[model samples]
Target: MTIQKTISLRPYPRGFHLITSIIEMQLAEIRQIKAGILHVFIQHTSAGLTINENADPTVRKDFETFINDLIPEGYAKFIHNYEGDDDMPAHIKSSFFGNSLQIPITDGKLNLGTWQGIYLCEFRNQGGPRNIILTAMGA
Candidate 1:
């Protein structure tokens, strides 16, 4: 059987990045299903998903900085100006990363690393709500 869950996040900033309820969602799904694969998906183009360190806040901050450095804002080469300066940059970031992640499940629990955590990567600079989808397959 496969179970699905969705979570909504309200970001405070346009380009604000944050780790969301992926852990909780996975736990909840594990409680219902036993021994399976967990699939997490972000239903947005300007955002993405990744598994990273959850023990320290600095890890996330450093990742954000690295991504920003990799894709700086206010680039003159961007042709998509439909939203704003951060519009095309958001797309680039999404492309570089991803919109979904898959994790293994074991004995009704998510098989995550000691410091591993799932995060929602918001690239757009528009404070709003984002939706994340989590699906689990198993008995």
Candidate 2:
């Protein structure tokens, strides 16, 4: 069986945020899925998705710091600046982390590790609500 749904997450600050619970809440149908895979894809170029530490807040904060430092805003070389200084850098950050993620499903639930969680990698300083398409496939 296969299922797909698009969800909109509330606007979040420019940072990596744990959205595992929000994603799980949208997957009520997954409880019937004994074994499967969940594909989460972000619809915007300025934002992305990832999986990482869910236990500590520092991890997420560190992610924002590291990526921002690595890809600072307002680089004089960027050509896509109509959206603002964060435009080009956001797209670059999105590519590094990616726009989608695949997670194994087992026993009707996400088979994530104890500290693993889904992350909404919001790169734009004022990114609005982001849309994510969730696709689950299995028997």
Candidate 3:
């Protein structure tokens, strides 16, 4: 049989980026399921998920810079600005990326690449609590 669990995270950021509770959720799921696959997802339009190098802080910084460069703000071409300046941009970044990821499970553990770690990408610029939904399913 398979079971699913949902976890939430309150990220304090407006356009600040952060790597969220994927590791902790995965660890807990592994303890419950003897063997199977794990799927982690974020239920937000302006947020995303990715697997990246968590060892070096610079890596994350570089990524933030790169993402910002890819989608610079203050564009008169944007239409969705109801939330704020960062709102439309956040949606763009999320569109460029994704909202979910699936990891393989083996021997009651997630089989991830040595340098691969799950992260929740926040594109909002204001520092406030953000919600993230994690769902895990396995036998």
Candidate 4:
């Protein structure tokens, strides 16, 4: 069996946020898939998706710091400044982290590591509500 749904997340600040509960809450259909794969695709360029240590808030904060340092804003080298100083850097960060994730599903639940969780890497200061497409496929 296969199921797909588009989910929208509440607006978050410019940082990395854990959204595992939000996704599970909205995608209740995943409970029906005994064994399968869940593909999550974010629908935005200034923000992206990833999975990492969910048990530590510092990890998320460090992610933001590291990314910002790696792709600092106001470089004066980016031509896509129509949005703002964060525009170009946001796009670069999005590409670096990617916009999608594929996780294994077992026993009607995501087979994530004990400390792993999905993340929404909001690069822009006010990257409004983000959308994600969840597709689950299995028996």
Candidate 5:
């Protein structure tokens, strides 16, 4: 079986937000596949998708802090300043974090680690709504 769909998320501030539940909620078709792989791709350039620690909010907070420090906004060297200081930095951050994820599906559920979860890394102060494309394939 195979299923695909695009999930839209509400706007969020610049931060790492846990969105595993949100994705699962939208892609209920995954449950029908006893074994498969779910491919998630973010359709925007300024944001990212990743899986990481989900038990503590501070992990997400620290992710934002460390990444910002690594690629601070308003860097004098940035040339793509058309959108604003955050624009170029957002692009850089997105590149580092990436825009997609592939997770194993077993027994009708995501086979993520016990402490793992999906995150939507919002790079802009107001990235507005984001779109995620989900593709599932299995027996």
Candidate 6:
């Protein structure tokens, strides 16, 4: 069986956000998937996705702090500053984190670890609503 859908998330601030609940709310179709893989892909190049700690908010904050220090906005060398100083750095951060994630599905539900959850790495200050494409495939 296979199911695919595109979902839009309300805009979040420039930080990492846990979106597992949101994704789970939209998985009614996958309730019958039995055993499968859920492939989540972000539509924007400046924003990306990952699976990480969800119980601690500080972990998300630390991610933002570290990535920002590594790729601070407004470096003199970036040539793709058409959008803003955050644009190029956002792309670079997105590359570092990546744009897609795959989670195992068992018994019609996500098989995530105790601390694992989906993260929307909003790279830009005003990245606006992000789009994510979800695909589930299995026997």
TM-score per candidate, chains pooled: 0.87, 0.97, 0.83, 0.98, 0.98, 0.98
- Measured with C-alpha atoms, the lDDT of residue 15 in candidate 4 is 98
- TM-score, candidate 1, is 0.87
Q: Please write out the lDDT profile of model 3 over residues 10-81, one tens digit for every residue.
A: 664543244534456534657666667777767788877778886766877787788888887878899889
Residues 67-132, candidate 2, lDDT per residue (tens digit)?
989999878889999989999999999999999999999988999999999999999889999999
- Candidate order by decreasing lDDT: 5, 6, 4, 2, 1, 3
lDDT of 3 at 14: 42
Task: Provide the clash count, candidate 6.
Answer: 0
- lDDT by candidate, in order shown: 0.76, 0.93, 0.69, 0.94, 0.94, 0.94
Q: Go through the candidates in order and give the clash count of each.
A: 4, 0, 9, 0, 0, 0
lDDT (tens digit, per residue) of candidate 1 on 1-139: 8888787776645432445354564447577666788888878888877888877878877877898988988887888968988888888898888988888888778788888877777787783687877788988
**Which clashing pairs does model 4 show?**
none
Residue range 8-96, candidate 4, lDDT tens digits: 89899999999999888888888998999999999999999999999989999899889999999989779998989999999999999
Q: Report the Cα lDDT for residue 130, model 3.
A: 42
Better of 3 and 4 by TM-score: 4
Model 5, position 8: C-alpha lDDT score: 92
Query: In lDDT terms, how accurate is model 3?
Result: 0.69
lDDT of 6: 0.94
Q: Candidate 2 — worst ten consecutive residues by lDDT sum?
A: 74-83
Q: Which of 3 and 6 is ahead in TM-score?
A: 6
* Between candidates 3 and 5, the lDDT winner: 5
**Which candidate do you rate higher for lDDT, 1 or 3?**
1
Count of backbone collisions in candidate 3? 9
